[model samples]
Target: MATQDTSTSTQLSPEALEGALAPLTAALGDRLLTPPADGFAETAAVFLGGPERIPVAVARVRTTDEVAAVVAVARDANLPLAVRSGGHSFARHGLADGGLVLDMRLMDGIEIDADAGVGHAQGGVLAGTYSTAAGEHGLATGFGDTGTVGITGLALGGGIGYLSRLHGLTADNLLGAEVVLADGRVVQANADENPDLFWALRGGGGNFGVVTRLDLRLRELPVVTGGMVAWPAEPGTLATVLATLAEAPEKLSGMVNVMTAPPLPMLPAEVHGKPIVMALVCFAGPASEAEAVFAPLRALGTVFDGVSEIPYPEMFVAGGPEGGASADARPGFLGEGVWAPDEAWAAAAIEAVSSAQHGLAVVNLRPMGGAIAGVDPAATAFAHRDAAWMVTVQGMALGLDGVPALREWVASTSGTLGVAGRGYVNFMANATPQDVSDAYPEATLARLREVKRAYDPTNLFAANHNVAP
Candidate 1:
């Protein structure tokens, strides 16, 4: 299991902090946010909640050269380094508890070469931020389902979003990347250049280096029929939706979410706490043909239908309870992939959500197929390419007080489904060392370690879903 970051209570050694400060402040100048600075708190705040980390300093880099310079400073000082892009890691792995954190937030730039249909984006960009901007060009790159997730983590770890089936995982669409290695060397990886590192970067977590920017293949996504449709909890209904989505056209991708309805404006007030099953889908084909494609879904006793022909970025629309804050929050996440779903599996899904003892609980069945499976499993570091159903069980509470029960629930539920060992790199929250290793196949793991040794032999960037050298 991952341990706590003690940087919160213990201050950095003044000499070491001072050592890193001079060159960093000189290179970054006013962009550096150190302790006692007015914006330090705001600069360090991550998504969900507090990382509880008070790093010696946070260097907000606006250029790739600056990223290289800050990296050299940390390297020369022998200080551990962390890379912060969007700060949306559920594990908050974006922050190095006590080390210098390179803030990539200011490098948020998106340039779409419409002629080439390629998107070159900075590491600090958010999924939603990029999606919105890409939508303006009637183009987009697949990312995590949420708008706020950082593109760097989401893409590097293997993004499964609304466009997953239509295109493929975010990493599959990546054409190239510019990475800063442990030795302060900046290199570009692509199909023809540094192919080994390029292979590792696609679906391999941020273990090799600090990625400052990425070049991704953009898709022509002018519109999509996407939204949520909910129903009162029923095992049969759940089975039908999962099966239907599995057999649906490649252009249609979605998630089957089972949980108590949150008090959203559209949902009836009385239904706030009632158990329900919701299917959120996006059809990337012609907008006019979406109704026909989703005809059968409406027949499943729909309680709410918000599907519409909205802009591509609208797929990131969100509602429901605000999850617990990052700090003081202990959440257990277990993910598995199944070939099919049955009534029993659906009932178990419902049970998983309702059994949470505290905070919030969610059970999601992300249907995978189409373009996601078209790529050879061995082509990228991601290996779970064939599973039709990816089941994720999540439980969150206020503190460590609720962790034991949450772990027990996840363990029992995952075991019951007979998928106890499967792991999705992106969604495996609060993961252990073994869990990180298990995210890839045996062969892939060996190759990743080899690449790890080559690029980051000492594992200088060890603050993510780490791949040990």
Candidate 2:
């Protein structure tokens, strides 16, 4: 549980306020957002849904200098600060209770150096934006599945996506990062420059500093073949699919979703409200080659097959809901490698899906192998290099009253899958220290702690999956 400071009334000195706002307003011009400003509430509402928190101020910084100025003010005033890029954080960590909320959404800039095969993305760029820009140049970088996910948060937390099996985790492609330390000092971290900080930022989960920009290595990705295939959800189907997926070629990557079929126009009407397995897939090779690769899956008797040759940008379209008040979700990593499946695991998954009373219960299984598994576990802060799949159980009800029951059902169902200890940072709702520790090995945790001490000695950036300084 998070300890809250319950003192009702707290104030900052007038001089501190003047000192903080003066230079920030001057440097950012009209980007600074005070409580009374237009769009202040909307800016605060971007990344949050369950609880409403009104910050003292929301500073929409456009550049690194503005970020430094905002940090300096927060430091001088002794106020907690929240950093937000795309504002899609699952735990609402991007919104401060009563402190400053630093909005980085205005910094969406992408520069791709095709000759060098590298791309520089500003903090606010979403995964979709970056992918589209890179696709124009016949280049690509690994990012999370969702288009709305910020590059800053996803890269820092070990990005797993369709391309992960072919290229690598997003952190693995990270060449460098421009970060503003807790003390408002701007620094560049990479293999040769501030190497320790660079290692920690890879999978450290935004604890060391606020990343202003990222330099990512790009891959040659002009076109790829991928999409979703939906099948009737039966008792033994899930187990059979998992067993087959474990043996599929690493060139083909995908995710399996067990959920109540939505009333979408593309889905067959008979499948609505019925249990279904929607497997989102991606292949990095040519269309003909991909067709050959996916032929085995096509033989599985899917109700609807939308899989075909498509542009890489279409991959982000597979992600589900971004913001809503009536959803309860828990993202976790399964521990066991791709071993033989059992009836128990399949039974639990079916029961969870069948027992969903209110709205929908989904078991999302994302494939993990190829380049992601090839990287050494010690190379970056993302320690789960060997896990076979990342699973998330989500239930969305009609009202707030259903939140507890939904959350409880998700927890209980996840436990029955037999791999509940490891948790994914991006999917974490409101996790404890034990949950965070379980995500990484002992050695990785120790190194992360040392790096945290060096970058944020006072633990000022303690919002997301914090590594205590």
Candidate 3:
């Protein structure tokens, strides 16, 4: 168990607290949390894992008003407040040292308007929940590959998914957001209201304020043709597959993973331990049309081909890994589209990943283009608007003991694939202060700082991708 810091020099006075917290508790009843509550441990455990830190208290807000109240309390107390949606920050950005943690997981609620092609999801809602709810209406929004990621975090960081090529990034479809400023004021931000904050929230991470609700623009989507296609681990075959995919249609988006084949019923027993290029693809079109689009890949002589026509929601299920264990690796986003020569750095990165000593190291390449690139980089805080491929180097270890070696391998391997030295905030696992700085451009960073100053002058919300106020 993580221990909490009890030094009161930085804490609020009892008199100051009485005035700020009395009305909040009166409004919320028993929703607020102190150190010794039964829910404290569970609330603290919400963070994904890795770093250990404990907050002075946990605020279990159930509504926008409750969120505002908690913010007010933290502000009055001069306490560092961490806002947690899904608690999925790779760097443990949702946990504070000894301050207040406003756990927003309880606020999940999804409402879909099929006729209007829009969906309203609360800040705490997970991507899987929103995807499933919208799928019921034959509608969908672009989100990250993972279903457990929070809608707030992914949308804010410019969500990428199967629908990215056809539609756009998740932030591109954001209609509006209800945010609670540091001053405890709730305001709706959109194109017509507080537009600067709206722009900042699109890709600025959690630098502005705590988003209570999000109104997202939805697309008319029914069935999607998608699944995995696994090819043999031979060097020539892997090289050809990647080269072919580079010129593939923008309507089809997929992720190519070069790693050791897992022992599954679908895989041949002979090819289980050998290396393989597992391609997870999703084509946003009719089943018949999608088959034709995937013909080139099918002809690649894959050892196992699992491609099939499935509903859009099923795509989410296919990408989810079976077990839950902590893994260490470094993640970076190449700013210069996918223009690297096949014989140069790209092939070298693949070769290094395939030969890594880590149990199942992989250089996962995600195709990006089309609707995602159509959006202007300056239109939102997400600056990697024109990137053609998002690559992640993942190393999965069995236990925490292997973290050091795995981290070293991932770091050195990522250094070799270097393009711009920048990274996508969502995939960043071991982001340093410089890595965080590199995620945003100078102009965006300056504007974010100003916004942080205006909203959280004292830097109360300093636990996330922090920006100095």
Candidate 4:
């Protein structure tokens, strides 16, 4: 528990603020930034469009000891502290309102041991960095869709990507982590050391401590058959896409998006700004079988087909679709098997997107359950193993004026299609206590709370989807 002498408010008095910031400034020099600093704006930016947050200060630390120093300062000051890695959090947990932030970007480092089939990644390492390093050794770890996302946050929230069906989740591949506890003590968590803390860290978010580094398990995957395949949106398009994915082997995984096609050079001019069903797929099996694996999708009348054998790292080179500067996203698990009357669901999604006048709206559906379901629910903090589809409805606009309508569209569409379950923590921004409760099962939440009690009883680390102690 935090000491009684520690101040519990983020807004410090002028004298208290000066006293609290002086030590960090003296120790870190220019690395410690206050408002109006040259790089403060860039360092404080959030990835997915959320309300802007101005942290009281930002510290760019290089080593684990430096991280501990920052944590200790924040602890003694009783100021809210947040960690920034890739800064891709939809909820923008990386930024603190009138609090301190540890900018871990300078800690980026990665070491690959091909012989041991493992990779050690610093908390600041991005998915692209780790994947590129591992790809050199014909190895890879399962991470989320985007390359710019910080690998640690993604892994902590149960990473799901093209390789998920083949290699389970990023959390499944986690072998160990080096963390700085709420009390400013540095420790290691793994199967044989601090086992309970390790279990909670796998999918419990950054509630217990500040993770400085991660030890990840890697698989030998030199290349894959992966790329985008799109077709004109139709009543039956979504069903065909999902049914094909369901029948696919574990080696194949894909994400389907129902949205208005943007004007890209590769796409026909006529298809631009028109509704379409686009599928981004990856097959990790034998390259020779790639064509056969994708034959069914081809039969659906593709307007564009870019699928082909390529180095696994190449898939992330271009990244995914562009998101609005400010966006609203709702992600949830689709239980009861792909929503009954697939055609109706598909039609509703298409209609919603087509009628949206303010901003871009998309209905995303990714098939779950292959190696993902093979893990028992009790094995980790992420409990949605039996789900068939991971669904998210999102909309983005230039300003706040267009937000209300987008929100209405998202809520209505989600209700119509039935996207109710423990929501995906990583995609949820501005989540409430009930949202946190809904993200975990009762037993899982209880166990997480126990770990929380043992590790962070006073809740010093409450920036994320907190599991209250």
Candidate 5:
């Protein structure tokens, strides 16, 4: 559905592109799609949508061989190739402007080895699908907060979620991977084989290759005490909730977001559009003690409470924003710890939200410790193990016209909150080279670059958070 802008000099020559796609056409047949195809838009619709999110061509592959074939064709043509799993790239990197896209959705498959407590999942598996499969066996793996997020992307970028403190990051659970390298060679990566690539694959963005399948470590998590609870976002309410969460036990992991209440059916109509502090928490310990662990937060006077013992997968489908909303956000790690907000900090944040009268604004804070910090910083590609919190300054507008103002508000709010240094790569959008530099330390980046050189020296996989050779 996305037509090339012929007027832009940056546009690829349509005739040349068509010629380059000939090999894939012969190989994939009807599985390959170009613009204006009946199902192209549906196949390319990722988390964020627009003309930019549409690629010149899409290849829907059902098997690893097909993926390798497509990758070989793309490399031979020297065409930029984007890979799509759950299609949630914050910067829309999953779709290429004038290149081919490898649609991995059809490859979705999960085989849970309950006896060994491991999950063998294809790269295309979504968080919810994997969780549901694992939940059947009283086992689970930590992905991000969203059900639709790709397990491969989340794990590769250091996934943090409700069970993060209990089970560690999703990357921490990754035991091995089947990667298709730049040269079209399919190889395995893990502690025992290709250890360097295996280390890079963990918490390293999609830089080295296209992962075909992953071996993830699962935890025993049949049911957890988890759900959303909220309080009116009065002045300093954000600060109080954050401080409380920071002091809570490691078994209790909370993701707190400050935003104006929407007109959801469960919420009282009177509170609609009013600022509120909402938190989604999970207690992995005894269900009976969930009440005690959350007592400190409940004492803050909750306006709504939905916390209860439930199936692990249920947490992903709980109340959330409607799909298709466009967000302008800045992600950062606050190594200094929770916001020790003064009166000024609270006022600035409140005003930032108020300015988005017709849109949506959110300040999300997730404290870090426990199993996440227990891992050595240099153990994997995710080096920010000592960070105290993960923060995102986000604003969602209804239309494109409101995005610019929202971006300004996000910048201003981020400055006020003092969000500095490297951020969680998964949350970064429209990141610059400087941003990439911030995401990794000098030693880690140097090592990653060396690996990039060894495997993908030509940089065939440059669409993701790139570590150039």
Candidate 6:
């Protein structure tokens, strides 16, 4: 079990806190978790360990009514509010500092309307669960690579993944949402209803309210040719691959990384723990033409080739690690707007991760063009749709002791690459207030604040990537 980091915070009076939680306890029955309560420690767990702010109480709400009740209780008590879907926030928004956290795990449910080409998922739904459920109907919506991330948080911050090039962002696929506002009012936000709130929720992060359910538009995804091809870490190789991918068809989407290879069956054993540049890709349209389209990338180095035809869920197989036991968090940042790489930064990136003495370490490069750029800049709160690349330098730490060194390495590596300014909201890890502000353009931020003021006037949902009202 993860130990508490109570050193950083003052604990609330147990008697007063419990009294404040009485109504919630009565309403939620056994679902409310208080300190020393059964499953209390487990309720506070998040993907990345060592999170600060142990929640004063955790309410695992299953229904929309339960969500409203929890919100009302938190509001009445004037406690900080944390909204958790899949318990996968890199910033640990799932936990709170003497606050009430609404854990949405019990709400995981995915219902697909095939003929309508849409999927309505409860807040607790994870990417893997939703993908498998929707894939069964031969339909999909792009999300983060990992299967465990909550679709609600992922979509709210603008999800980028293997199918991003073809389908745009996860937020772009959002058709509607059931939201419990700060004052305990439940309403639906979409293009035709509460339109301004809908715009802010797309990429504005979870600053307005707790999203209980999401209506995502799904695309027909039958078969996709996807996998990785690696090369020894050669300077300019990643840039070449990115340039090629920038011009590649919309059906193909992937991520580039410089990592020390692991001894997996798909890769040769000799290359483990050595610098390498690898590209993981998915060609969603035609299986026959995937290899041909990937020819230029293979020629870059081609030490290992695992590309093959597979279902969309198979694309997530061995797709890096996050949450649960995979605590060797790879933390970094992507600056605002589109990036046309400087080429020299690729060398800096490869050199940076090569210095890691132990555990998983790498610099990631995710291409962000194709259909992502096709959206109007002001269309959604995810204002960086025009970015060509989202870059980050992440690596494993030797537990908490190595965090200082790991963070320093990441900072130096990113400084060399110059991916500064606003960052991707989902990638907002340990970001400063100014850094968070940079995530949106001026006009986008202004409009988002307007919506924030209107809905979350007192800013009860300030634990997320807060757009303060």
Query: Evaluated with TM-score, which candidate comes out highest?
Result: 4
lDDT of 6 by residue, 25-75 (tens): 998888998787888887777777653467788898889988998888778
Per-model C-alpha lDDT, please? 0.78, 0.79, 0.75, 0.83, 0.81, 0.79
The count of residue-pair clashes in candidate 3 stands at 1
In model 2, pairs of residues that clash are none
lDDT of 5 by residue, 1-469 (tens): 2211211121458877787778788888989998798888877777774335456789998888889988997788777788879888776778777677898888899999999999999989999999999999999988888898898888888999988877789999899999999898999999999999998988778999999999999889878898888888776676777777777788888798778887777777787888777888888855687888888788888888899899989999984455444555678887543334554665666666766654678888788877888899899999888877888887777776777777777777888777745877888765676677688988889889999999999988888877889
What are the per-model numbers of colliding residue pairs?
1, 0, 1, 1, 0, 3
**Per-residue alpha-carbon lDDT of model 2 for 86-138, expressed as tens digits?**
88877777877767878888889999999999999998899999999999988
Write down the RMSD of candidate 4 (Cα, Å).
3.5
lDDT of 3 by residue, 1-469 (tens): 2212221223556566455567666876666665567777777765345545667667777899888888887777677778888777766666676667788889998899888888999999998889999989888887877788888988887787777777888889999999999887888899999998998888888878899999999887787888888988666666666666656667677778878788978989998876778888888777888877778777878788877887777887865664222354455565455442364555576577667765567788776777877888788888776676777876666556666677767777777776335677776665566666777888877888887787778876766666678
Error of 2 at 318 (Å): 5.4
Summarize candidate 4's per-residue lDDT along 98-137 as a digit string, tens digits: 8899888888999999999999998899999899999999
Specify the highest-lDDT model's number: 4
List, residue by residue over 281-382, the lDDT tens digit for candidate 1: 889966688877888888988888888888878878664235454322222222223345788978987876777666556677788878888898888998
Cα-lDDT of candidate 2: 0.79
TM-score, per-candidate, Cα-based? 0.93, 0.94, 0.89, 0.95, 0.94, 0.93
Worst 10 residues of 3 by lDDT: 1-10
By TM-score, highest first, what's the ranking? 4, 5, 2, 1, 6, 3
> Quick one: ranking by lDDT, best first?
4, 5, 2, 6, 1, 3
